[model samples]
Target: MPEVFTAYVRIVDGFNRRVGRIVMYGIFVLMGILLYSSMSKTMFLPAHWTLEMAQFVMAGYYLLGGAYSLQLDSHVRMDLLYGRWSPKTKAVVDVVTILMLFVYLFFLLYGGVSSTAYALQYSETSYSSWSPYMAPVKIVMVIGIALMFLQATSILIKDIAVAIGRPLP
Candidate 1:
């Protein structure tokens, strides 16, 4: 059973790592394309399109990078106090923080789903001339929030196991 659980964890971790890298790289590529388009637009099309593309790229970058940031533990934190704690204490703090994040992200996911549904129903699009499909971008928020939530849950589970002395497989 422990071996099976270990395998599961490894599989999940590997999958998240791969997905994170893909999303991060995808954002970079998208940004590059947007940059080139904007540069070309300065001479060809309207300048407004460049702003729209920039906005889309920025939103996409943040959403897609969220899970990767969490996975890498690169997100900002107030370590001034947390850094002083012992391993066990740190584990406890981590568990608590994960719980809080889980709750917050769950709410975000709920809201995102609702918003996506509304957008879908209304056939939402940007009010600007560039008017790309807003539904897709909105949907990405749900995916990003859900992924972050899952990562938080996974960390919380591992931290709880450690706190109880069994530890994670």
Candidate 2:
């Protein structure tokens, strides 16, 4: 509808797309970690970090890619009534219902930021034997959640545009 909103959508969409593309390769990293874990278990003593590292990578992969998934409309939905709706109807529905998503994302982001702050302040570590520092992953979580929030806002703007018959490119 406005140049500012159009710019925001473009920038957020482009950045998230790049991030998602890069993060997609994380699956290979996870596989490599698992492969090494298996080999080490058979050939030598199992490493303490492999399991936990894999978990971290998986979390980063999904959480970081969340905005991209939303942009692509790849996130799961009920689709019961949505699939039958006309484009303009869908945009109107999305404009209204997206408020709930914003609320949810706001709470999630708040909690993530608070937890990340605590982790950074206390130099928190996992309870696992390896006990890796928790701040890095917590920071990643906060960043990912923030990106999702931005993407959700962009979606709302686009939906508004569509509802008003000024659909963005």
Candidate 3:
């Protein structure tokens, strides 16, 4: 692989790793929120925001962790044939599939950005009791999707290198 492609993979991988590690702690935040909700309901006036906040945190956790999961190859796959394939064969197949992933991510990112814009422009709020502004979560979603897209691109580069018998380290 060329220096530029190798550098791009390194940078994207490093950034996604850092983001994933930081986002992992969000699970604890979610647990704390749920705990507080339970305590408040029994001992005091229930907070109106707990459920929605938990949902937002969970969405952040899942979406933000996606690229890291991909990096680790931890996402579920139908390994019926994949596990038996040789390394180069796997790389060849991955390149093709990752192209499809790019298309999906492109559409997802476009919609996320559009929805985020609408949220910001209209000051959109959830139709709930707490009625929190939607922009913050929407922004997080966009960031997560963009990160996943970058990570997918990095994977594609690496796969291409492998397929060409010039694998990057």
Q: Candidate 1 vs candidate 2: which has greater lDDT?
A: 2
User: TM-score for all predictions?
Assistant: 0.85, 0.98, 0.98
Model 2 regions lying over 4 Å from their true place:
none
Q: How accurate locally, in lDDT, is each candidate?
A: 0.75, 0.94, 0.95
- Look at candidate 1 and tell me the lDDT of residue 90: 81
Task: Using lDDT, give the best candidate's number.
Answer: 3
Model 1 residue pairs with clashes: none
In the range 1-169, model 1's lDDT, one tens digit per residue, is 2665556556656666777887776766666767778677777754556667667766767776777687788999888888888767888889887877877887888899999999999999889987777898888788778777766666666676677677765
**For residues 65-145, what per-residue lDDT tens digits would candidate 3 score against the true structure?**
999988888888999999999889999999999999999999999999999999999999999999999999999999999
Ranking by lDDT: 3, 2, 1
Candidate closer to the true structure by lDDT (higher is better), 1 or 3: 3
Which stretches of candidate 1 lie above 4 Å from their native place?
Answer: 1-8
- When 1 and 3 are scored with TM-score, the better candidate is 3
lDDT of model 3, residue 124? 100
